[model samples]
Target: MFRPGRLQTAPNVWKRALSNFESRITRHETSSDDKKDLILTILSSTATKREARNYLSKYPLLKENDIYQSHRRILDSDVVSQTSKHDKLINDLLLKHSARSEIQLPEPPQKPEIQLSDTLRVALIRIPTPRRLDPETLRGIALTLRKLVQLGVSPVLVLDGKHQIAAGESRLLTVNDFVHQCDTLIQALQTENLQARTVRGLFEQENFSLPELLVVPLLHGIIPIIFPTTVKKDSTEVVMTPFETLKCLVSNLCGFNEAYRRNNANDLLTVEKIIYLEDLGGIPSLERFQSSHVYINLLQEYDDIISELYIGHLDSSVRDVHVQNLTEMNQLLAIQPAATGLITTPAIATLRHGTRTTNPIIYNILTDRPTISSSLPVNLKKTPQLNTTVIRRGTPLTIHLSDDQPDGKGIDLLEFDRQKVIDLNKLTHLINDSFGKTLDLEHYLNRVNGNIAAIIIAGDYEGGAIVTWESAGGRRVPYLDKFAVLRKLQGIPGIADIVFKSLLLTYSDELLWRSRKNNPVNKWYFDRSTSDYCIPNTCWRLFFSGSRVRTLDDLKGYVDVCSKIEPSFV
Candidate 1:
């Protein structure tokens, strides 16, 4: 085998070369990270880079862009640069090692902060076997994984062999051929310090509680790579679809049976994060500023997103993958609402694009939130983070109208009585906590009762929007009386975004809300609203959603009504 880096020698010669190189560098007193980087940087310029790409290139499903792939690929793109750097690094390290080495390695940055919460320590990552293994992308993924293990956030890999079946080659091969090839070649290779045990598939044998085989590897800091292959009744091993494999894991992880409930008797692993790696990247939606949906509140937006994928995009191939991804997420997430579902492409996962310096998966494990906020306007962003989506099950939304009446199948909010559907005590608690002010409950209810248009509540009043109709210029206009989220929940994930989404479902055409000019939440409100203006003589700033606030009369109608509304807070 050709030695990696500047040396094109046999194995024995390569070992000696590494020894001599390390010995020479040891005298320089450089950091371990710097030494490793200088060694890998020089070696990466060798013959093996092409071999790495060629080995995984057989699987056509991987189509990672050259730019987004590991940094090694960047070097490979230009032959002259690779060769020149290789020769120069060898010359400097060997010839100049004694004369105060001229090579200056960049100082290694500090280890990233990994904050593992209750379920953040472990992640069940579903990766389409790392094909098109550009050595650099592999390096980035491996480096990040090692750091996670060091920080106690161990990740288990579920290897999906979809391309083998999707490839036209499956038509010609026998089932035996498929099993042998899929079992052997689909393993995650070429990375340092991470071991992968390919479990032919998840099992439910009468004797085995799914313990012995899987636990040992993990205890030894190995990543257990579960293949999507299962043995059938007749003992013929058949490959399952990626989604089918994940479904079985979810059932066991959620502890469906006594077998699964046991500490180690589970048929599936206890999964905190069910991460899906697809070539299509994140879920898509025409409604978002960017084409990809950054965050999906599955309870409210799942069916609509699924419909969006199916109807508009002519390329059903990509659309079908997106649908399957969300469908799998929605189903698997059914058992564990606390569990998170992340969808992103391999390229996006490995690519450190724009201002992002860390791997997205590693970042997600630490934060439990997407790197980008869902409602952040596209234009305000300094860089584009359009690929990954942070998906979590949302609280079910229920809307109630006043007088228990409907306007032609639509629940009109014109007289929404909070006393009817919403628990008054809980609503009072929510409003008081959100505004940091004590509410005069009697005064608030009396003021909003008859003037209420609709009451929208998200999950036992975790978050809510109170809308009321007001009379101005002899016209009754919808005014956002208060938009209250539990102050504690204000810092939680996607609460405001979900509440606002629910509001639009009920009031599709127009709505108006206001906040004090100095409130920090004004930035959040400004991003979602259609227009805004400061009421000339007052501290309040009125904001409107929908196109109706364009003309002067519309502005007059907004200010005239918003200014007259009475505050129920002390």
Candidate 2:
């Protein structure tokens, strides 16, 4: 009854063996499901779609559409709802399994490395785009780069190809590479650093290379040129031709006829007619010449007669006739002052008793002049008289004169801190050194305080030199050499008036004389004295004498005289 390997020989025995085999196969199939579940679990844990897809690929039974649908169902259904009961169970199972073991993943790969060539190393110098860099940062970079070059080190140059700076870079590379025979090749590198918020600052920082200055044609309008088309021997028939030929004739005439041709010759015929008239005693009653064109035509027809008149062969004798006519019309306002029904003011008497300083005289004249009150609109029978009572007492005066030192020794002292005896040549050098670039001292000296009475050039070891003096009106005159300062104080803005008033505050004196006779420091006489003598003591001490006065007290005697003469002097 019991047969081995037979399906039905021993019914119980066959059943047991078949059961064992079936159990093994069932275990193998279940193991595959476990692997699938593991993968699905991993995929579910993923944060992105790609990871989920990779996880699904491990199980051929898993479809993307199925998983996507499941995901949508999970998102739509609530955990407590009957529709999501299966999903909740599956999710719980996956979470339990995932908590049992930890999964290890690989890290992301790093970016590729850049290997620079030896040629590129020598060629590449770091050139930051100035437009993209802050002004201070660019300046610092330039300084550092220059320092590095000075130290014989070359760095890489970074550039933005899309900019006007490309031209400059090309020029620089050409000069540094081909011309110099040095390998200064630039390598292009893509960078976000080249984008700047403000480019104007870069231009103002003076850190970038500039292109050569060139003048390009800027046409505004067409310019017309006229010339003779053809010349006839008989000189009567007119000829017409192309405008170019006329232009050529004009150019030729301009080059050849230096006496008659002008760059702006709009009325050439009029000028010719005037010349002809000048020769023939001018046009008689020019007002009667109704049409300018007719007059010019008549002048052209009688050209020979006009030439004879120009050569002084005419009966009129143009020069004599003009002279006689001018003499006869001398009574006209053109030749003489108009005699109107108004009283003219005579010159006021000059004040005699005062310190007789030339500056005081000029100052007094400027102050005492009559104010024109009737500069108003309206017809009035009576004119305003000059107010003599308004002539306030003259103020004390101070005159400041700014003069360059004789030689550059002072400037040398400023730089080297050494005391050196300076002669005229050395002083000239000093002045040139100080202001040679923007200004010249000799030209500016006579311009400032043109009424300066005296100048003192004091030597100092620490300060190099100090120029101190009182300006007219006793103001402590500050140094004003720069044209900018002069423009602010003396030009259109009216700042000069305020400054002059401030100067008058300290220098006004009533004793200051208003007459040239009372003022001894007149320019003509002082200049003459200075020119005639160079001895330290022979001429005026403040002027010719080279003696050094240590204090303001030394100038007291001169100041007293000026003060006594002009009460306006301070």
Candidate 3:
């Protein structure tokens, strides 16, 4: 977080510095010394000129809380080609700063983007020990694994032994207990006609090397189960901690390994997902005062969340486990731009989880989306608890609220929109692309001309909102005129959630919007809305949301906007 005393320079002076930094970074004319000065200036929070404003409310007049988030957003949302000079420079610069400051950078070593030659959609699945899982849970896990295989998602299981016992057979309990567990799960998978093989690799000391021939099994459609055991210089195999093994494997798979660097590995394996089946469940939080985070943008929330967990005063063992899960999750996502990770209970991963029919692991692998949106309102969360938390290499969000101006005078959002201050063309592109229809831009302006309230945009227009003021009688309602996310970004975990979160926080008063009765996103709207109505004589369902009770005037305003609003689509 941005601390108050970090930046002593006047805010206006920093503004000039920000302009200079922004202009110079992209220009060939800029000198290296100037860029270094710009980076050092950003080490302070209050003077940050970062564009990732969604999580920070006091943006522009930045607080101390924005530094890590700003740098992370830059890294995670970088759209430049990995092989490009621009991408390399950005990565190098950020890394140099992070290392100089000894800051825990969120990304793993930047790896080459998945190659076109790679044919396998491999997932690294971390499964619980057989001793820990009941028979029913084991069966459920088998079935889920079967489905993944049928869908062409090759599963590489990371089997961990009992935490205390490092090596022995599964007879009673020991370190090598994972061997028995791995065998048991393999047997169950075979019963369902899923081919699985136990894979034990020799890790040379601390340096992580790819197990010789692990890729061969994946190529032939056989599941490879990796044991978390490493060999010392004396050649003795020691069962390392589960995450210890996972860290090594993640590095190898992401091409941060000797094998990959030598062109022997990472040719066939494109790690699509890293599924961690935790018996305890997702990272516990205090959302309503919370456990599962539903979705985590590690780039934005990791440090803050870790700090929260350490201070949460929960059970030490459970907290450690949750923290470790997030630790691996961060590395897993940092593997590549399209990398994804899931941490859910064995029950949620294997059997039915709440109202969802699809397994969380399978669901994420198939669609690259959370089973439930993270941006879902607290009241609408149907699942008893958010058992499954899906994570993705998420995009950054920039939230600009009309009511945030100081001196008691709000910025002219109306003029801003008209002047394309919010990048009207890109916002229009988002609406058009997301809705899959051509927008009558002129007509849209004519309808919401004076009603435009706020426009929230994410990324370079990956998702956005155009809300308006709807009036009836003497009352005005905040109307959600349009909420859209690019189709490509629909599966992204945090995009919709952040968009919805911004809406709720920005409009604390009763906000109203309507959707076609059959619109696919109505459920999202209805879940968050306080009350909803199926407007008579139209194919629209009117929705209202806020803490305030709906009065006759509020109702009138909501109904008028929901029922009378004109469509802006061509």
Candidate 4:
């Protein structure tokens, strides 16, 4: 691991220096000494530059002018064929600066336009371990990988697991550790998204870079490779080493004949047929840095990798249970793919199939259908028909008022269509079961004004809302005081979706609600909410859908005051 003792200068300062030098270089016919001085000044390390100049002076062919010209030659080369030479020259400069403990790393290649290759199936590349990567450097790496993947290259990143394990040896390897690492990678990839979003959250703004102008050379016909690592041998058993496994995978991916390789031990593989894998520590020397674009492609890839594996957003215990289930299922099926020796989901298979979109599998999951599709690698014993009707149609919502008779002569709660009045006691019974607690019947009736209600069907409330006005920011905001459905109807396809959509359509403009932090349904609430707040020392997270809570102060005040209300469930 190369420990860079001191980090490079700020990006702005580097850009300013480059800008100044470019203007100077174009206008002036400076002397050789003047040009050398400018190079040293731009490098920002006089001592290191002097030593490098002395070293280059040893060769008669390497003039001061030639050294200056080399930098221009590198920046001008527009093809991947010429990158290797430029890479070596830059590495030589970096190594010299490393020795001196002062190096200003070059700015990322400017806006490298990606073009998908017709032939390459996968391009295996390495990235720096998390600690060494700043957001800019990480963005550069992600953009490069995305370009490769866009060009029909399946980028299988080889992270430095050995180093990570060694660094945290005292701490045991757990799912949390893996999750943290994945989150870091995902955050790095989301640099693009972080910049593009309109609202700049406190942390998001500092960690990600905004887009900048750049022009990078087009990458073509470059198949960079590094030797694979070796594993220990067992005396009694024959096992494939890591390198052997890698070679076999390469052979398979490139369609190399195993028989031909077996007959000749020293058979040289063609470049087109071989897969390239690089060490994370060495990738810097091989490629130029990158700048992030506003596109969300890298974030999508990160989501796909984690979600397809079913590891994202899961706690350790849940992940373990899932893995155990998979293990048992795999044993029962007796089917394992050569790639990972595990049963693959349609979502994962879609990624490996080189398809950019996992919409088919996603559509299946969203519609509450099976997580796999007919396109999965393993053939199922029975395959269901593609569901045409994921959503169950429902009658539009209606709000109805109770019979306005004095002295409590009319019903307190009535159906939306006003065809019949709902028995408050029956409504309480159903709500108690749905909420897993006795409904505060008196408080609920009072909040509903003992008259008006929003209901799905008029005869009896299938799903409904009982709301009251709350004065927030000097406005009568409709607070969703209590919402419930019959326990039997819960999770029935489109029951909640249609009911909520209809309710929102009725009161399209401003509403507020607070859900218990522990509620599983909070995810649904959060998704619909335009703005939200999590009050400290409280169980409820208040959410607002409309444009009422415009200021942070108002939002905070509303959430803090509303969350203090006594537990509504009971």
**What TM-score goes with each of the models?**
0.69, 0.14, 0.67, 0.31
Q: Write the per-residue lDDT of candidate 1 for residues 1-570, one digit (tens) a residue.
A: 544753545667879877855654442332234334423422332223433343123211112211123444322332121122123423433353435323332222222212222121347777765454465665555555554554345477766667766764553363454445334432323244345555543454321224333443443345656655666556555666677767766665455333434643322234667888777788876765436777888887788888777776538688777887888899888877877889887766663222335455655554456766675544333426577887999778776655455433323222233335457678778888888999887777667665677777888888887787776566766677777888656655677777776665456567788888999888778777776899988888998776343567777888987777777788
Q: For model 3, where is the 10-residue window of minimal lDDT?
A: 108-117
What is candidate 4's lDDT per residue for 175-275, written digit by digit as tens?
23434554576565555321111111101111111010000111222222221222223212122222232333343433432333575553222211111
Q: Rank the candidates by lDDT, best first.
A: 3, 1, 4, 2
TM-score of 3: 0.67
User: Would you list the rank order by TM-score, best first?
Assistant: 1, 3, 4, 2
User: Which residue runs of candidate 4 sit more than 4 Å off their true CA positions?
Assistant: 1-362, 365-391, 401-419, 423-426, 450-460, 568-570
Model 1 clashes, total count: 8
Candidate 2 stretches greater than 4 Å from native: 1-547, 551-555, 558-562, 565-570
Clashes of each: 8, 63, 18, 4
**Residue-wise lDDT of candidate 2 within 232-336, one digit each (tens)?**
344332222222222232233223323323543331111000001011222222212210111111211233323433454324554354333222222121111
lDDT of prediction 1: 0.60
Candidate with best TM-score: 1
In the order shown, the candidates' Cα RMSDs to the true structure are 14.9, 40.2, 23.3, 25.7
- Superposed Cα deviation of residue 11, candidate 3 (Å): 99
Segments in model 1 whose C-alpha atoms lie over 4 Å from true places: 1-120, 132-136, 147-151, 167-192, 201-209, 232-236, 256-270, 351-355, 358-360, 376-385, 401-420, 472-474, 504-509
For candidate 1, the per-residue lDDT at 266 reads 25
